[model samples]
Target: MHCQPDYKHEVYIWLKSNQMCLLCDEATHSAATLCNTCEIDLPWLTDGCEVCALPLPISGLVCGQCQRSPPAFRQVVAPWTYGFPLDSLISRFKHQGRWPLGQMLASLLRQCLQDRFDNAELARPDRLLPVPMAAKRLRQRGYNQAAMLARWLSRDLDLPLDEHLLLRPHDTVAQQQLDAKQRQRNLLKAFALAPGAQVQGQHLALVDDVLTTGATAHSMARLLMQAGARQVDVYCLARTPKPGT
Candidate 1:
């Protein structure tokens, strides 16, 4: 028999509260799907560049890349480095259509961001903007993971979201398949702002599932900045460590 949406939601919540840890298979004993021990053990990005969030030898130091040429965004905020189970989980969520995994990660990211907001470590954005996907790619994926993340974040954070403000009108090479330079080249002139969108003096956050090279974030942030956005920041679940680190 089919269940109503509300009933399904209630069931989902019930399962969540009684869930096993996604990694360790222990009873979570909490609303979170991850047990505290396993959660703490996840590849947390403890010390990183103040601007780009690249894992660093010490806290509060800028990576040389960012020092020489800062990104268009003010900062990148992520909870973990792209490693181990997070890499596996993100791959499954993005390519295999396991949205629950994405939802779980997004929930954790929300908690992390909330703590930062409480501590004044990072200022919240005026709106959440999911990096747009090309139409062909969106059709193949069925749902844009970035958009899903943004929607979940918007609801939980009580932040406004503008899905239509950014547009990826043309398809580019899959970013994961390219080197940083190639990825940058692939995205050249690949993104566009929606006509009549008002970004002037606004602080924006670009939401995505993972940040590998920062190529896409840079491209999108540049687009928004050129349109007079006051500030742009990236919010993602994971940040890849520096290449070969």
Candidate 2:
């Protein structure tokens, strides 16, 4: 005869699937790593430029910068503006080597991408390219934050990840320490495509944790297009708003 489920086993299963908020001890009512309250309160972007996803006064309007000179990447899909607790969490994950926070943030980004897809705000692409880390930085940090996020997205989205296809030939000074003009100059000729790789007529999605000055993503996209990728889109977790916006 079939037997009834064990009461203690049922409780264990429920507890395992129901996760507490990462920010607090309260139950999140589901398997989500973050609670609804925290997720909603995060710095979500509203009005923005389509090309670079820069914050603008109105939606569907191109920013002055993009109008004058468009970036190589076609569009940017970023859900949150970089600030507050999200910034602090990313800082810890990136600087302190806290892997759990990185994982949690990746999961949240997957959810955000799903929401955008559902609402027709974004489109799916053929491949995901995690931004390459310089060898020195990789050796020091023990991980690439972009690659870590790409790993999670690869599974969640069931998309192919070209994590190793892009290579950084030269290590430039930190982009954070430079102004936008300096960032652009520093990133010139910084990325190279591996020989024998084929991306002709393919839609590539560049994955990164954040977009600061847009120089790095633009540089990578230019290289991809020059190498014959049909289209390039950016999928980043966060974007810093324009100063004085």
Candidate 3:
């Protein structure tokens, strides 16, 4: 059996009840100030590439890289660009054992989805799939941050969360250090649909904590397509803006 974090649900409930900020862990002043930390230090992504959500020139819809070679996922949605307080929060949630932050991240993601789908004509997914981590990495982390966020998102969106639909078969090298081409190469064959997991004719949304090179999400998207998923949307908390843009 996979090792599940003990306080995942508990922390989520606490955040819902306490009215604390997701970013700062203090009392929230208003709907605008959902959390204390978000008020003063909220890292916002004002200008981002439409295709991958990477920070870009405010006027362009797609980044040069994305235009040259599009990714497999249909669209990417992220509340903030990876930077400052957002980066610190992600680090805490993933590495420092702060599971409550997952709830906060999910809350933001939920809001972003509402905003995106409200005035747009996009179809919502039938199910949510968290990008699976390798078994070895899952053991070391004790929990998959993507899974945690997906659980909360599933509840918020009234969609089913499919935890076993995809598996990360190989532990690929980190994408942070790799260029776009190298990143894609490293993630090839890193993911596969689990045996007997049927996604035929289903619209699936892939959730993750961050979108860096888009390599992992693209790999997962390819696997889902092979499993007969009708469509795949990528959702994440943060998008690391391409450097210098």
lDDT of each: 0.88, 0.84, 0.80
**What would you estimate as the lDDT of candidate 2?**
0.84
For model 2, give the 10-residue run with minimal summed lDDT. 1-10
Best-fitting candidate, measured by lDDT? Answer: 1
Candidate 1 per-residue lDDT over residues 1-245, each given as its tens digit: 11111223643674467778878888887777778898788899999999889999899899998988889999999999999988998999788877677788999999999999989988989999999988888877677889889988999899999998999999988898998789999999999998899999999999998888798999999999999999999999999998889
Q: Model 2: clashing residue pairs?
A: none
Candidate with top TM-score is: 1
What would you estimate as the lDDT of candidate 1?
Answer: 0.88
Query: TM-score of predicted model 2?
Result: 0.89
Model 1 ranges with Cα > 4 A deviation: 1-17
TM-score of 1: 0.93
| C-alpha lDDT (0 to 100) for residue 198 of candidate 1 | 96
Candidate 1, residue 68: how far the Cα is off, in Å: 1.4
Using TM-score as the yardstick, the better of models 2 and 3 is 2
Give the poorly placed runs of model 3, Cα more than 4 Å off: 8-13, 16-37
The candidate 1 region of ten consecutive residues with least summed lDDT is 1-10
Which has the better TM-score: candidate 1, or candidate 3? 1
lDDT of 3 by residue, 40-63 (tens): 466777778877888876745788
What lDDT does model 3 reach?
0.80
